[model samples]
Target: MSDTRPWIYSTDHDDPDPRTPEPGHVYVQLVGGPLDGQLLDITGYTPEERAHGALLMSNHGLHGPGGRSDYEPRPGAPDRWAGAADTT
Candidate 1:
């Protein structure tokens, strides 16, 4: 599967939600995969979107090009997120 979706690098300063984020960038570390230790730059994502994480494209890693690495947000750490074996 591919996580191919349209993305834009813009943050809304006038956003009404205050508990999530304030228009900035955040990085999440990938763990057990070809993209291990690779930090994905989610510059224009909200907290909800961040929590969902993503299946990143392994273009230049052990999996080689066109490979997808599944990653999820580690609970209890909002500002700082790390990868793990299981997030349940």
Candidate 2:
């Protein structure tokens, strides 16, 4: 998956909001495929994966306490990503 957009986190709601992700929360924008532009929460990734995911985000110029990035959507599986393993 590729990071091509800025990562943003919204801190307005009491509960976890897909529209507004907080620290430790990851929001990825899916690119290409049926789920393109869809925002996904990837907080369920393994610790190692999360670290790598953060690095990927950084490489794409997305930097912040929260893990967020614009990701290239995986083929076939809209909710699955090759870069970030879906443990859930």
lDDT of 2 at 84: 38
Please report, in order, the local distance difference test score of every candidate based on alpha carbons.
0.53, 0.43
Clashing residue pairs found in predicted model 1: none
Instruction: State residue 62's C-alpha deviation in candidate 2, in Å.
Output: 31
What residue runs in model 1 are displaced by over 4 Å at the alpha carbon? 1-24, 60-64, 79-88
Candidate 1, residues 4-76, lDDT tens digits: the string is 3322212244645322432465655555555554456676677778878776555544456665556677777
CA displacement after TM-score superposition, residue 25 of candidate 1 (Å): 3.1
TM-score: which candidate is best? Answer: 1
Where model 2 places Cα greater than 4 Å from the true spot, the runs are 1-18, 47-88
For model 2, residues 1-88, the per-residue Cα lDDT tens digits are 9654433333334644435455776566554332334455766767655434322332222244343343433555544444432111
